[model samples]
Target chain A: AQRVTQPEKLLSVFKGAPVELKCNYSYSGSPELFWYVQYSRQRLQLLLRHISRESIKGFTADLNKGETSFHLKKPFAQEEDSAMYYCALKKAGSARQLTFGSGTQLTVLP
Target chain B: NAGVTQTPKFRVLKTGQSMTLLCAQDMNHEYMYWYRQDPGMGLRLIHYSVGEGTTAKGEVPDGYNVSRLKKQNFLLGLESAAPSQTSVYFCASSLRGTSGVAGELFFGEGSRLTVL
Candidate 1:
């Protein structure tokens, strides 16, 4: 069975501090992973994908194949970066479907 | 463009009541999906449609039915509402891609439903 797990329910950090949101997955075949963010009163949107390997809003997630982990990280946390973040994985097929993990609510304190 | 839109942004229903949530995407995407958002569960797939008439059960599909009569629309129906079914539903769409190439899923604003 393919599963995505985001261990943290809530993560608190102060502004200018480093941040890390852990995500792990279980899949037999090679998997595709992505991070989605939901801001206040906003729709859940794509933040970054492991494929691109490019940082978005100063956030980066590297897919660790050996550990099946794709942890999201930021050098300096910003207050505005606080929001609900979800990790998702796609099953391979003609009609791809996403399997999302429990979200992490990051609250950047002043 | 309203990329993806869900109707009835807010709803309240009693137990055993039935309701349908509609999701429409204007991106001409071939894939549409329905998911439920809970406090800690993030989002769980309920159902998905590949094209105009093809539908498939997702990770969690009990007590829910989906229809894709039109190319750009996918509808999720709850035959009988339950307290457990009370959640925020989200609809998403994505373009066709294979294996590792499939990128992001565009999501809607979400529809909050409460079952009393």
Candidate 2:
């Protein structure tokens, strides 16, 4: 039984300020984590993944195995960054299905 | 390339009525998935298919059914519509093989469904 949790349902940040969306997961085996973003009037897309270790749109997330967390972070917020962010987890060798979190609605205020 | 396309972008149905949502991918992906997005609940996997003619239950599979008769098409069916089933549905596809396990998923614009 694996689960992903995004504690904050909504988060607001001023333009140019740093932003952090918290995410935690409960999985005993090794896990692959990813952050998916949905922009206004757009389809959901992958923002970043722990395995790739590459940042997209200036956002990055580090997987913390000890704490069972994979929080998404950005150095500075922009109005265009406002969207729904979901944290997902995939078990190492399961059915290749991802378990998603409740999601965080990030609003970057200008 | 019309990466992933879902037909009937918007649909309204009455309780007890049934309908099917169609998803087609042109990328030749061997894996397809159906998910429902609700406010605050994020996107929950309803069902998924590993390849043609193979389907499996996902996180929230109780109220929905799915089929993957064709390699490029995955269909989600609702036997009886209910208000609780109203949500935005998304279809996604990914490659298969060693790189498929943790590959990125390409998604469709999504289908909005409302059960009255």
DockQ metric, candidate 2: 0.77
Which candidate has the top score in DockQ?
Answer: 1
Per-residue lDDT for B21-103 in model 1, tens only? 99999999999999998887779989988889999998789999999999899999999999999999999998886544466
Q: Tell me the TM-score of chain B in each candidate.
A: 0.94, 0.95
How many clashes show up per model? 0, 0
In model 2, the runs with Cα more than 4 Å from the true position are none
List model 2 lDDT by residue over A44-66, tens digit each: 99888899888888999999999
lDDT of 2 by residue, B1-116 (tens): 98999998999999999999999999999999999999878889999999999999988898799999999999999999999999999999987754633657889999999999
Native contacts retained by candidate 2: 0.73
How good is the docking of model 2, by CAPRI class? medium
- lDDT for residue B70 in candidate 2, whole number 0-100: 99
List A-chain TM-scores for all predictions. Answer: 0.97, 0.98
